[model samples]
Target: MGFTDFFSDVWDTFSHPSPDADAGGKASTNTPSSGTDEESGDEKDVNKDDAKDGEDSEQGHKPSGDDDEAEEEEEEETVDPKDELEEECRNSQGCAQPKHHFDECQERVTGQIESDGKAKEDCVEEFFHLAHCVTSCAAPKLFAQLK
Candidate 1:
C-alpha cells in the first residue's frame, strides 16, 4: 500500500480497536453448557457445601462492610489499558479539532501555502507544517504518524 493508506490504517488501529481483542483483551465468559443445565443438582451441591462450611467461617469470605470496599477494588481492577489510552487520545483530539479547523480551513490554508512570495521548498515546508498543525489539533497521535 502507499504511504497515505498505511498511515490511515495505523490511525484507524488507534482510534478503533483490534478485532483480535475480546473486550479489551479480557477472556470471554462463554461457558459451554452442553445445552442441559442441571440447576437442581448444582443448587443441592452448593447448599451442602454452605452448610458444611458453616455461616461464619468457611474460607476467605469477606463481610458486607468489607465487601463495599472490595467492590470498589474490583471496579478499579476492571480498567482496560487500551480503552483508557484511546479515550485519552480522543479527548485530546476533540479539544484540538476546532483549532485545527481554524488553522487548516480550506480557503485560508490554501492561500497560506501558495500565496505570499514564499519559495517552493519553503511553501512545501509550510504546507506540511500546516497539515501537521491541523492534525495535531484534532489528533496529535495522527500528526505523529505523518512524521
Candidate 2:
C-alpha cells in the first residue's frame, strides 16, 4: 500500500465512531433532530404521492409503507466495522482469532521456558516475535504461502 492509503486507514480507525453504541452513531431518537426530520419529510412526500395515485386509480399503492421495511433490511446487511468495534468494546471483547492467537503464542513460549528451567529475559526479541505474529495474522492471505 502507498503512504496515503496507510495514513488514511490509520486515520479512519481513530476517527470513525464505534457501531456498538446504543445510538448507533446516530442522533438520539427522542430529539427532534434534523436527520430524522429529513427522513420523515421524504417519507411524507412518498406517502402523499402514493395516496394520491391510489385514490385516482382502482389499484392502490403503498409507497412509504414498504420503504421503511426495505431500508431496515439494507441496514442489517451493511454493517460498519467501527460499529462492530464499539460493540466488542461494550462486551469486553476484541477482534477474535488474532487476540486469542497472540495469547496462545505467549503462553506456549513461556511454558517451554518453564519446562526447560530457562529464564526468559529477552524483551526486545519477544516484542518482535509478537509484532510479527500480529501483522502476519492481520493479512493471512499475503503471508499464507510463507507459512
Candidate 3:
C-alpha cells in the first residue's frame, strides 16, 4: 500500500468507528450510564452559555487574536474563487440570461487560457478588450438576425 493507505489504516485503527459512524464520526456505544441525564443537561447548559457568550462577543469588536486568524485560515482552506467560478461556468446548461450564459462560456475559456499557474492581471486585460469587441460585434448582428 501507499503512504496515504498506511496513514489511513493507522487512523482507522484508532478511530474504531463502524460503517455508519455518528455525525461526529467518533465511535460510541449506546449503553446508558448512571450520570447520562445529568451530563447531558450540563452539556446543554454549557452550549447555551457558549452561544450567549459568542453573541455578546459578536456585538463588540473583541480581538479574538488567534481565533480570527484561524477563521481566515479556514476560509482559505474552504473555497477557491477561480476554481468555483470555472465550475459554475462549466456546469451551466440551464442558465437564464442569454448574455450571461455566453459570458460564462467565455469566462471558462478565458480561465483555461490562464491555467498555467500565472497571475490573472494580463489575462483579465486581454479578456476585457476581447469581450468588448465581441459584444459590440455580436449585439448588432443578433438584433438584425432577430428582426
Better of 2 and 3 by lDDT: 2
Tell me the tens digit of each residue's lDDT in model 3 across 1-147: 999999999998987756555668544564335556544666779988988899866655666798888888878455544444444443444322444645666676668667855434344544454445455545555566458
Provide the TM-score for each candidate, comma-separated.
0.20, 0.20, 0.21
- Our tally of clashes for model 2 stands at 2
lDDT of 3 at 69: 85
What ranges in model 2 sit over 4 Å off? 1-94, 119-147
Using alpha carbons, what is the TM-score of model 3? 0.21
Stretches of candidate 3 off by over 4 Å are 1-121
Candidate 1 residues lying further than 4 Å off, grouped into runs, are 1-36, 39-47, 58-147
Q: What is the lDDT of candidate 2?
A: 0.59
- Give the top-scoring candidate (TM-score): 3
Candidate 2 local lDDT, 1-147, one digit each (tens): 999999999999999777755554555664355544444666779988988987877664656678888878788565544444434433333344444555666787688788987645434555555455444444444345347
Q: How many residue pairs clash in each candidate?
A: 1, 2, 0
The whole-model C-alpha lDDT of candidate 1 against the native structure comes to: 0.58
lDDT of 3 at 30: 48
